[model samples]
Target: MISSPPKLREGLEVIRGMDDIPLIFDPVSGHYHRITRSAEALLGYLDGTRTRDDLVAYFSENARVDQARADAFSRQLDTFLAGLERSGLLEGSEQTEQGTGASPSAGGKRFRTSMLMPRVVLTRSLPTVLEPVARVLRALPARLIVVLATLGAVTGYAFGFHTLFTGTPGLRDLAGPAFLIATGVMLLIVLAHESAHALVAQYLKVPIRGLGVALLFYFMPVAYVDRTDAYRLRGRGGRVLLAMAGVLSDGWFCGVVGLVALNSSGLVQHTAAFLLGMQMFLLIVNLNPLMPSDGYTAVEAAAGLTNMRGRAFTLLRHTIRRQPLPEHLARFGTGARRWHVTYALASVAYGCFLAYAMFHTIPLSVDLALSVVGR
Candidate 1:
């Protein structure tokens, strides 16, 4: 029962999102909270000049509600304001008794980190360095770039694959120096892919926290840029573009290399063809929706959902066990329930298909490698 009018802390930014949804960003915590439209309206009145009773009276007058209904509304408003206070969005308010402070979500953790995917941050100043490039990209015709890149990728891959299976050099011919050259090119492609994500995020005014390298699953090395702040973006379009930027850059690289492979001969042709194949393989992995890849992120952004994979898998587990739905899930609307179940089943099926493909492809790949290395 705070008698004083609760004021929002200084430096909090409220951005309007899709469908007029409001998102409040707290720079200190580097987290953003999605709030309802009504909540946003209520926030406007909390300028340290109005108390809880004043809000209730305002609501009563506006809605033409009786005293009984107004009392109920007052209680609801209290709860909402209390939540905001706990989230550290209110000025001069302490967190809960536990002293752990409020978090961005119910999970109570801002970041998902694991030892299996350890990252070494390369630099925190990428935004400043990449600002000029981002501005240039923003100034260009985005639709034209997308169209050209898409068309080039399709044409180059068609010709490249034709050359690959028809009359290109054998694995023996592509060994040693050609192989090393292709590997170097593949590494550069990976760097460009990550840089594209960062650049798009910067263009959208999302904070680039860091650029880094990480060992995914404790083995596979990957370049990653921390664009988690993209979640704070107001529009779904910006978020989806940020997610797909890496894939687009990969397509552009493949397009260039694939065309080169189609026209060239000797070592250059072999190396470019090899690099194209490697890029295609990486694209497949990146675009697998069953995993937490770029494709999954894009889907989540498009649907304006969060933690879809986690929710889907949880629902799948409960269904398999014939157990009751968890409290949070039980609250889902009809459409959401169906979506979660469908995604879960689809993920399961896709995973099986991948396992089957790998089972058959691994032996062939090993044989190809052995032949190439002169074993």
Candidate 2:
């Protein structure tokens, strides 16, 4: 479970979206909120000291929203706080004077400490030869053509997928070399994916923070583009575009590899087929909606779900613990009700799926090695 900083007050600390939504913060007993822009401006006055009336007056003077409007917004804000409280995102009894003092526990910052430099390596401007490739992606139709050509090459290797003991070296005998060469091609395709993402970020005028490789497990190095700057885009569309760029590239690469392998003949063609198939498998697996992979981001972008997954998970656990409900029990809806339910269910399901895969998906050889041998 994701725990909030203990020092920070319970309730919505910040409401993030295009429209100004209320991000409530209930200290202890009293619930406070900032719905309208005027109310948000008054947050500066909360130096852990101001009274409610003082805060209200400050809002009226500095950011003038009529008293009635402000009052209405405040009430809605209170309602939101109450919901959060019931949902266990807020603490303390109602009617209690929430303190304006420092919290008892000033929790330290939570950081994922790593010896490795946390940088993604695709953001550096592409090499001259790669620039044309990026430009061509801007035209997706032509891009599809290139992908088909690659797939054709991959498919061309299939010599009828038969295993024969003839004088001629057959497809099965060549599987080893085929896998290695195919892996190399797939790696290039992976690079293409990273390049697309970086290029898109550059095109959008977003600065590439850095690029670096991540050690997947131990030996595998996954390329990454650090485009956190793209998150600052005002609209959901831009964010979605940046996120999808990689997946789009992967999909295109898969298509191209498949086409090439299926259309060719002989050992090289067979190798291409195997390699293309492997790439497609990787694409599908990586795009599994459960994990924080390309597919996960794509789903988040398409659904316009910003923190909806987090909130849903929070709510689902709360309901499970408090309601004593069975797995099949129907859940009640709240704000963004449908999306909340979907997001929560998906999050939980995906979480469980990932846990299962991590523990149980080891290779047979690894399991054999771990077993104690009794002679």
Candidate 3:
């Protein structure tokens, strides 16, 4: 073993919980770690005076790690140290003895949709900075808010379903300046969607870290609020509510717009109709449980796992490679595996659905393009 002391990066904030597992935040990377008790204790051994062997001996004894598990424990520790080095969280960067081959099902080789779409933060602590608004919203009755949101969502869906079933022969009407107005409204709805997430999280006393717009595949602008810190909620219910808030906001927005579409005339009616189309698209796509959007995050929160999607992908990877189930999968039990497998199936189905949607959805937007090209 390499004999060098590992020092944690300075100014790191660690939030210790009732479960003894602490959540460590690295401001530099904007990453949070929910580390086990042993892992939390291991950080203390990073003093410059301690050696690798000493650190291993200390954790191994405290962990009561048996002979069969000692090797695995050492490999994990070595890997964690390596990760810390990579993140610039360690003062000294030294290679460990073992390769620390992480389990694929345990987020070793997990993939992310964010890899396709990168984000840039415009503001941090946006909710805190807008504390006066949060305070006003907090005083409002939760039951009333939930009731209105639920009613709006139901009305939005009912109106939308009727439109879809009745056929949109009015697509030709959408090929006009009204489309431009609708596009602008749709953009505002995106911001409102993110705002809803922030408001709900703030009301729940879950700190909102930041809000920003990201380039989706370098073109489509996607707005997001950083309510990720809410994952540490002791109960999944709060996290689920937070996750669903954006979608709920879309429902209310579309419901209001749909009513205008029904009651208005001429240019106003056409613009409202155009927005209604976009809103339905948002509802269908965002509410999809398979996408990496709010619905998927809600599923993750409900399951109480931060790496739910990654773990699901890992299961698929192991199955394709014909490898034995990873050690972590063993804890899920048979019933859990059934749901995991179902999720895997849903994920695959979504991939196919997206392929079809893109094929059709692209041409649907061609009118907007032709308008630009003609000019």
TM-score of each: 0.73, 0.53, 0.74
What lDDT tens digits, residue by residue, belong to model 2 across residues 1-375? 112211223343544332334344342322233245654544444444554454445555766788797886566444433433343443342333221111111121221112122322333444344556556655676446446644543443232222111122443344454556676777777777777777766655554444556543232356665554443445666666677677666655555555555556666765666555555556665676654456666677666544434445556676657755322123444555566667677755765665566567465324433431411
What C-alpha RMSD separates each model from the true structure?
5.5, 11.0, 6.3
Candidate 1, residues 1-375, lDDT tens digits: the string is: 767888999888887754456878776665666677888888888898888888889889999998899989988788778778877788997633211112222222333444235666766777888899888877889877667756765675566566676646766566555666888888888988888888888888875787777765554567777765675676787788788888877766766776687788987998886887787788887888876679988888898876677678778788789999855577789888888889888876866676677678777667656766677
After superposing candidate 2, which stretches have Cα over 4 Å from the reference?
Answer: 1-53, 60-174, 212-224, 263-267, 317-342, 351-375
What C-alpha lDDT do the candidate models reach, one value each? 0.73, 0.49, 0.68
Question: Which candidate number has the best lDDT?
Answer: 1
- How do all the candidates rank in terms of TM-score, highest first? 3, 1, 2
Candidate 1, residue 363: lDDT: 78
Model 3 has an lDDT value of 0.68
Rank by lDDT, descending?
Answer: 1, 3, 2
> Tens digit of lDDT per residue, candidate 3, span 135-160?
88778887787788878878876775
Worst 10 residues of 1 by lDDT: 97-106
RMSD to native, candidate 2 = 11.0
Report how far residue 206 has shifted in candidate 1, in Å. Answer: 3.8
Instruction: Flag the better candidate by TM-score, 2 or 3.
Output: 3
